[model samples]
Every structure is written in structure tokens, then in C-alpha cells.
Target: MWSSKYSEDIKEKVLEMYLHGEANVEKISKRYGIPASTIKNWISLYWEEEQARAERSKAASRRKRRFVNGKELRVVRPTSGSAYIDWRRK
Candidate 1:
């Protein structure tokens, strides 16, 4: 029987590859000796998180576009020489 602790880590790695569009659930399950259904569940959770992240990024961009509700912001360079903060809003 697989332990919950190890299964959790395996689930993370499986979901990572799935989210990156590299592997499907069946392949991941075969590689990890886990069930396809479990892999599918993990993939679903990963996609949900990915969607949430995309939503957050969209919201952040929208917020950066307009001076709203006195939100405190910290500027960080997303790339080298891209020193302008909130450049995504542009």
C-alpha cells in the first residue's frame, strides 16, 4: 500500500507535469504506479489552481491600470532591464 505522505508528493509532481501540458493522467499513473482516477483528480486540482492564478494575474493587471482604492504596491522587476513596475498594465 502507498503511504499518504509519499502519495502527496507524487501527486504534486504528476500534477505539475500535467499542468505544464507535457503528460496526461494515464501516463503519469503508469509512471508513478498510481491509479488513473487519482491522477485525474490531481490534474483537476492543478487546473483549478492554474485558473485561479490566471484570474489573479488578470486582476492584478486591471488593478495596475488604474489608481484604485489606495492599494499599496511593491514594484519588482519581472525581467532584466524591465525595471518598470506594473508594466503588464501597459
Candidate 2:
């Protein structure tokens, strides 16, 4: 099977064009010389990532709102090298 490698920048631009109502999948496929199915796959992947990011932000915000001694405490998560945390506020 032959595969074509498209850079992230090109994928993002094509998805943006489709999302902004500037063109349909068929037209975009023709213009960019990409298959309609490939374009659709890119759009689907973009939406999945976006939904995951939204969910992560929501969970982080929920974790941030904690009460201790009638005072709100902010929870901070380390951004690197650690996946486990005891989020209980002391």
C-alpha cells in the first residue's frame, strides 16, 4: 500500500477551511488533491482531539474548586513526569 504524508500545518489549514464553511469535502479534495475520505478522517480526528481537550479542562477546573476551612483552595497539577497525585486538600 502507498501512503502520503501530509504535514500538520497542511492538515490544520484544510480542516479550518472545511470548518469555516468555505468549502465542502469534495471541493476541498479536488482543490488540495487529497481524497474526500482522507479529508473526512482528518476532520474527525481534529474533533476528537478538541473534545478530549475540553474534557481535560473541565476536569481540571473541577479539581481547582475545593473548600478548606471555609476558604477556597486551588489545586495544582504538575505538568510533567508525573501521572499520579493525591488531590485531597489539607
Candidate 3:
């Protein structure tokens, strides 16, 4: 199947405009000459990407160890157990 390709910059701008309340989907579509459905898809895609990025950052922070009393401590979850353990305690 043939598909249309749009530049990343245009996608970002369209999403930014919508998210920032600068314009609604219909207005943006008219201004950009893109279909309303296409604009909605871009908005949804941008929102999902933002959510995934947030989740990744949270997971990364959870994985990082903290320094306390000159010792690095990490919170670890066992694969076979539901309990959480502090690495410094064991």
C-alpha cells in the first residue's frame, strides 16, 4: 500500500499548536492543508509518545541508585517475589 510521508518538523509544529491551545484540529488542518483526521492521528501519536517518554523517565529514575551515608543504595524487586528489598540491607 502507498503511504504519504510528512516531515518530522511539520508533525511537531502541528502537535505543538494543538497542545498549546493555539488552534483546534479543524483550524490547524485548514491552515496546514492537512485532513482533520490526519491531524487527529498526529495529535494522538504525539500524546502517546509523550506518555511513553514520561514512563521511561520514571523507570530510569527508579533504576538509579541513591547515595546515603557514603553507601549506594538501590531498591530491587525480585523476579519471583512481590516484595521489594533495599540492596544495602542485604
Candidate 4:
């Protein structure tokens, strides 16, 4: 059975190998005995297509509505882990 947890270093190494064209996920999975699905997940998480990357950048500046303390507020939360709420925006 494969270990349930793998270190970040190991993941980085695998990602690098894949990105560098050393091998595709199936080959890497077989070589390292890891599941191909797991490697694919890492690729999706780490590698964004250009359109997706741009969309993500746009979303960072977008404001979404949320209810906080019985008030509908527009919250602009960037990917930077900070949030600001505009109560008057609604």
C-alpha cells in the first residue's frame, strides 16, 4: 500500500520531473508507485492554463455578496488572504 501522506519535497520533485518532460503522469506513477490521479491533481493545482490564470487574476478583484451580521455586504477578498467588506455596496 502506498503511504497516505507524501512530503512537499517529494511532490515538488515529481512535479518538476513531469514539467521537465522527464515523464508523463502514468509513467511517473508507475516508476514511483503513486497513483496517476494524484499526480494529475498536483498538475491542476500547480499548473494553470493561461486563460485560467487570467480568470483567477480577474476574480481576485471581484466582489462577491455575503451576509454578515444580518446585513448583505459585498466582500472583496483577494487570494492574498485578506478581506474587506463594503456594507454600502449593496
Candidate 5:
């Protein structure tokens, strides 16, 4: 698909204007010379991206960071009451 020459800042500003009810698609279309359909597309795309980002953050927050199935390190005491370092995995 061919991309527009308009910068992201301009697109974002247009989207904000439309989303905030400051202007309608047709009004913005006239002011910025962008098609109404293109503005609508940007709005939908932005919404989808925001939803995906929210879901990703929620998933990340739901995960655990604790050790899972890893070997533990500790000191061992024998019958002779001598403490020795145990570096073997059990």
C-alpha cells in the first residue's frame, strides 16, 4: 500500500481533533486536505494498536518472575557435624 507524505504529527493532530469532537471528518478533511476515509482508517488503526498495547501490558503484568524448576544452592551438614559447600544440582 502507498503511504501518505503527511507526517505522523499531522496525522495525530487530525486524529485528536476528530476524536475530541473539535471537528468532524469532513471539516478536518477540508482543513487538512485529507480524505475522510483516510482519517477514519487512521482512527480505527489507532484504536486497534491501543487495544493491542493494553492487552500486551496486561499479559506482562499477569506473569510471574520467580524461579521455575531451577537448582537451589545451599550448604550441607554431614553426620560428622562438619559443614561443607554443596554446589551440585538435585
Candidate 6:
């Protein structure tokens, strides 16, 4: 694709502008002399990449929460006992 011919830096800026409603594909294409389809492709690619990143981040946070909440680490000491072995719940 013609868009692939451009450098990563250029494509990233184009994607940012498109995402923020600062510019549409046609406007950016005309301004940069790139193809409109290329701009559209860049925008699509950017959104897909961002969605995947968000999903991964959400999964990581869920795992951390489960690990922290599911484990019981508190320790309780046993009280004094007589001749017979006995256990009591506090």
C-alpha cells in the first residue's frame, strides 16, 4: 500500500490527528499529498492496535486483583492449653 511507503513517525501523527477529530482522511491526504485511502487505513490500524492494548491491560489488572483478594495471609496464634489438646475458634 502507498501508506506503507511513509515513515512510521508520519503515519503516527496522521493517526493522532484523525483520531482527535483534528482532521479527516481527505484533509490530511490533501495536506500531506498522501492518498485518502492510506489515511483511512492508518486510522483503522491505529484503532485496532489501541483496542488490543487496552484489552491486555484490562486482563493484567483482573489477574492482579484476583491474586490479591483470593489469598488469605493472616496468621492467628494459639492460646495456652491444659493437659488435653484443645482448639478454639476466635
Error of 6 at 31 (Å): 0.6
lDDT of 1: 0.69
User: What is the Cα-based TM-score of model 2?
Assistant: 0.69
lDDT of 2 by residue, 5-70 (tens): 987777877988999999999999999898899999888887898899999999977764667776
Best by TM-score: 2
lDDT over C-alpha atoms for residue 76 of model 3: 68
lDDT of 6 at 30: 91
Candidate 1: where are CA atoms >4 Å away?
Answer: 1-8, 17-23, 64-90
Q: Write one digit per residue (lDDT tens) for candidate 1, span 1-90.
A: 233545666666876788788887788888888888877766666678779999999998886434335544447778877775442321
**lDDT (Cα, tens digit) per residue for candidate 3, span 31-62:** 98999998888777777878999999999978
Ranking by lDDT: 5, 3, 4, 2, 6, 1
Candidate 2 residue spans exceeding 4 A from truth: 1-4, 64-90
Instruction: Report lDDT (Cα) of residue 8, candidate 4.
Output: 82
**Residue 36 shift from truth in candidate 6, angstroms:** 0.9
lDDT digits (tens) for residues 63-82 of candidate 4: 56577777787666776889
* lDDT tens digits by residue: candidate 5, 33-88: 88889888988888998899999999978865443257545556776768876554
Show model 4 residue runs off by greater than 4 Å.
1-4, 48-90
TM-score of each model, in listed order: 0.52, 0.69, 0.64, 0.50, 0.65, 0.63
Candidate 6 lDDT over 1-90, as tens digits, reads 124678988887888788789988889999899999777777777778889999999996675222234553333336455244233333
RMSD of 1: 9.3
At residue 62, candidate 1 shows an lDDT of 82
Local distance difference test values of all predictions, in order: 0.69, 0.78, 0.79, 0.79, 0.81, 0.71
Q: Which consecutive 10 residues in model 5 have the weakest lDDT in total?
A: 64-73
Stretch of 10 with least lDDT, candidate 2: 81-90
Clash pairs, candidate 3, are none
lDDT of 1 at 3: 37
